[model samples]
Target: MEKVREFIVIPQKKPETVRDLLGWHRKLLFDCLKQELKKRLIESSITELNRLIGKMVPSFEGEVLDSAAKLKLQSINELLQEAREELLVTKKVIKSFYKSNETIIAAIVKSHMGEETLTRLRDQHEDTHPNLLHEPGWMLEYQVAKEQWDKGKAAFLTFGTFMDPAKADVIVISNPLDEKIEFNLDWREIEESRE
Candidate 1:
């Protein structure tokens, strides 16, 4: 059994204002919710995989439990394949959740900073802004923004939900605000192309 871990990040000093308190509370709550969802999804995948593997074991040599065991072994492989596909699908769904939240955050920040300010910030950061590019969710936004800029489309900064290191999803820049975008990267393709 895997031990599930929960993380909480509270402000160094207690929140002084009502808005600060609310913002902190919301961040903590959403962090927990996101972790729980990820845990559940992972556990579900493991359980299904284990169940299928167990069913497969009975079909091996020795005193095979009849043709039923063989059928079950075949079924196990199919089930495992299905589980893999489902896991990929689930990952995409999770990514989409973060992307949608990013959109909302982008809108809020844009409203406050104004489009020109956002563009200036992006330009300042595009090549050399160390902090923005290295931050947790910012890289994704930066990549999306760069892609959109290359295509002459509007770019946006948004927040992304992530688990490792567990910090509030912060600003990320995305491009092509009107089009549905996916950040599926194929490392193998990139490597092959380079060669």
Candidate 2:
């Protein structure tokens, strides 16, 4: 008989707002969810491979070198190659999940943070990354904005629910409204792109 280790999880600060809830959930469970999903995927794949190899082993017990045996070996090799490919794909899926989730979460938080909160956040970021202020034109702008806009356009495009269509209508503007600048949105282009 084996004894399993018992664990107890203690809850921390309670969340007051949706932003707090999202932040807490990400901090507490996002990494765990990613790791658990990866673990389960890999475990199932290994179990399937082992079961396949086990079933195929009996056929090779007393078999002499023949075309059939060679075919079986080739098939096994193909399965192994597929498993390798699947692992690579698994990595890609996990990476995509990490990137997309971070962006979506940031978008939601950004919406909630508004101008003042973002200004404070930006101040903190600037304090930490003073080098960003010195970089050349586009690079400087990109470096400063990258944190706020992680796949910003793509994330915003898919943001919000059908039930709340208004939330999804994100408009990007460079200059302030007071600035003498003409801004136009082609509704036809937007509709075509959505399709």
Candidate 3:
């Protein structure tokens, strides 16, 4: 009864209820897992593309293109097929990622403005993103953001100038499609730099 006489105990504010803390932790875990998966997928895709590219015909300044060039055609065809398959898989991965991104954006929109506002935000995003239309891979990088469509359409939209314009070949906005994704002969300049 010594301290019970007139002692007033102030209850400490429960530090972020257990549920809130757990929710935050879970979100962090999800983000980490998603990023790791995405990294692995992108790496795999790049490896596949590189492998295909390695098997293709070497570039030259003025190589004679014989209509009857059958020596490397078979190997090139096989490599092309493999590349196509890998691109298809990559397209699926990209679509999944896009859906995830959209979901996250939608969540943010709903949190701040509600569902009705989300549609407007999405429209605004599409409008503002203004892709450079129908440019080849090489020029697309310098002038626009390009995305690979499932139907083998590579679409581009102008975003802005590159930080170091000379170093910027193209900023690939999306993964390649499943079909034989080929850049125009004019766009070969960008590809030559890698060689």
Task: Give the better candidate number (1 or 2) by TM-score.
Answer: 1
- Candidate achieving the largest TM-score: 1
Model 2 lDDT tens row, 1-195: 123232211124333343333344334334434543664677587678777777877877886758876787678768767766666655554444334333433334456556565455445433231111122432433333344345332112211112112222232323222333211224355456456
List the candidates ranked by TM-score, beginning with the highest: 1, 2, 3
* Residue 64 alpha-carbon offset, candidate 1, angstroms: 6.5
Q: What is the lDDT of candidate 2?
A: 0.42
List of clashing residue pairs for candidate 3: 131-156, 131-157, 131-158, 132-156, 132-157, 132-158, 141-170
State how far residue 105 of model 1 sits from its true place (Å): 0.6
Model 3: per-residue Cα lDDT over 1-195, one tens digit each = 012122111112211332322233224324434544555665676576566556554652268746554445655566656655555554444344334333333433354456676565455454332222213543544234223323333332112111112232332223333322221123244345446
Pairs of colliding residues, candidate 1:
156-174, 157-172, 158-172
lDDT of 1 by residue, 1-195 (tens): 223232224444444443343344345435534643664676587688788777667656477467876687677677766766655554455444444443344344455557675455545443331222234555565566567546654433333322111332333333333443322234355456556
